[model samples]
Target: MSRTLINRLSHARRPLLALAIVAAALGTAHAGYNVWTGEYTFTKDELQSAVDKRFPATLRYGELVSVRLSNPRLVLDEAGNRITTRVDAALSNTVIPSPPVNGSLALNSGVRYDATRRAVLLDNPTVQDVEVQGMSQYREQLNAIGAVVAQQLLKDYPLYTFKPEELRFNGKDVEPGAITVAPDGIRVQVNLR
Candidate 1:
């Protein structure tokens, strides 16, 4: 092989080697580390089992037709040991009612479930009219639907009461629209209307 050609081949090989190293590093960071830490030991079935045990009769993953989470609060207890968590969650979906309705319906509502207190203390609900074959249902049915939605939301995302227990918070009763849980911590997002 010509000297110039050999040199060019060597330069190309260096980049190829660098690219291979980078790819291996990324793979290790994404998946290899999980294997070493035993984080990947929990299979989807195992996770679903745990979640189902914690939240029975609640929709899991794709079963959730709609969901809205709002108003989160995180606070330290008087003892400053555990963290208190509170949030209002709203959810809705279609299900085969006992005496199944021939048509579909819409439900909506909000609820405050406190993990510390292990209680559902606050519920705010509203429902919209659902027409079946051009015939509108009673407002009471709509309200019932809303209540069901709220109850389901509570069931699905039960308040993390354990946080307060762990933090040693006083765990006082919470009110509606008072606080909420955020991605980072308890944060209230103000809306100017």
Candidate 2:
């Protein structure tokens, strides 16, 4: 064995070990920093604007009458790992040969992500509560009225559509996997692919 070669090898081993340690530390930090987890929150006002745009201000059941929605309010809930939304609307109905009927409508709905449709859907909106002002004479018809209004209002509406280009991570679009309804707003959890 040559003494010079052995001495050179021994000196090189220290730097090699140091380089390996530095590489490991850098890898750990990169992994920690590169975790792409983010939530997109949709505020109440934003949802209201969307609803206003998607649905009409006045809907008619027949030629003789029409209902108008005003002062829309939203309440969000997280149930069974899904989103449940309730919309409270001030309703004003105008009927021919009658003045007008004013009331409040509480529309309860479940929100779900439809994989096949690639959209966020509001499913089966039902009237959780209905308040009719100055209509005590027709109390028995309140539920029926509310149900019809709800059905007509939210028949086939998609609250959100997944545009792969819109949801992005690191300048590349990502797909969202889950949505949660919170008190403050709706949160969409995006996955980085």
Candidate 3:
């Protein structure tokens, strides 16, 4: 009777173990579908390329001829939830046919998502500093000008725009609630709709 009972218990244990394994596998698969959060990283080179494609190579303001941007650099701060960009601007004028005024500008900006527009927007960008060659006396003017230029450039150009494909999971569209930047990368928080 003891031998018979041991055989019966071993037979039951095999099926129970199999059932537990199947349940674990199913749980893992289910977890993938419920992953509402994901991070996408962008290097400075990638962002610079995107900006180059969307941003105008040159902007004009009356006498400001061929105001060109060069050597674009991007810095992300996740802790502060801010992004800082450094760029060199070459300002030329028709009146002063000499060398262009070489200026470096640093723009610090916060991130915001526009649900209605379905795009990422830079919020309240301020000019951290502007240094123009041999123009220390006009530092304030340069800073203001740089801020205005940065705002104008960012107005229509979004850092990232969500396509129907990107914001969708299992064919359902979701919203990107927040955009945060870190030293390493940018993170988009997804909100399931």
Candidate 4:
């Protein structure tokens, strides 16, 4: 009777062991999905390239006055959580044949994710600085013009966009929470909706 009982206990342990293994496997898979919050990173070159494509933009106040901005350079400000774009600028008066005032315009901007667009956009951009080669008298006016141009060009400008699948994970919809500027790149927080 003792040998028969021992054999029955061994048979019961085998099924229990198999059940435990299956339970652990399922738990591991669930944990893997739960552990993911979502972090999207983009390199400096990628941001720079996005900015470059919009450039050589001309803002005209009238037929006589126009400002052309081109050759943008993007700088990530990790500490400020902002970005800086410096573009070569040429302000010209169609009436004046003397020459175009050549200089560079610098803009500082924060970022936000637009759900409707599924893109990261430049938010609340301001004219950080302006340096013109020969136009010392018109610096103030130039700064104002730069602000308007920057607003039209950079405000809500998409820095990065997400595909339909990129925002969906494990059959769940996720959205961008916050944007962070890093030394190497930009980091976006993702959260479930």
lDDT of 3 by residue, 5-73 (tens): 999999989998998887676445533222433434455565566666643357777675567777767
lDDT by residue for model 2 (60-131), tens? 655655666665666666553333333434444455356566777777776666766666667787877777
Each candidate structure's TM-score, on Cα atoms with residue i matched to residue i, is 0.27, 0.62, 0.72, 0.79
Evaluate model 2: give its lDDT.
Answer: 0.62
The worst-scoring run of ten residues by lDDT in candidate 4 lies at: 29-38
**Local distance difference test scores for all models:** 0.37, 0.62, 0.70, 0.85
> In terms of TM-score, which candidate is strongest?
4
Cα lDDT of model 4 by residue, 1-193, tens digit: 6999999999999999998887676445433122334577778988998888898898897677788899999989999999999999888888877578889989999999999999999999999999999788988888888889879999999998888877776699988888889987788887989
Clashes of 1: 11
Compose the digit string of candidate 1's lDDT tens values, residues 24-126: 7744553311222222122223322332343223332355234343443333232322233233334445452233223333332233545446532223433
In angstroms, what RMSD does candidate 1 have relative to the true structure?
16.1
Q: Indicate whether candidate 1 or candidate 4 has the larger TM-score.
A: 4
Instruction: Check candidate 3 and list the clashing pairs.
Output: 78-181, 78-182
What count of clashes does model 4 give?
0
Candidate of highest lDDT: 4
Q: Higher lDDT: candidate 2 or 3?
A: 3
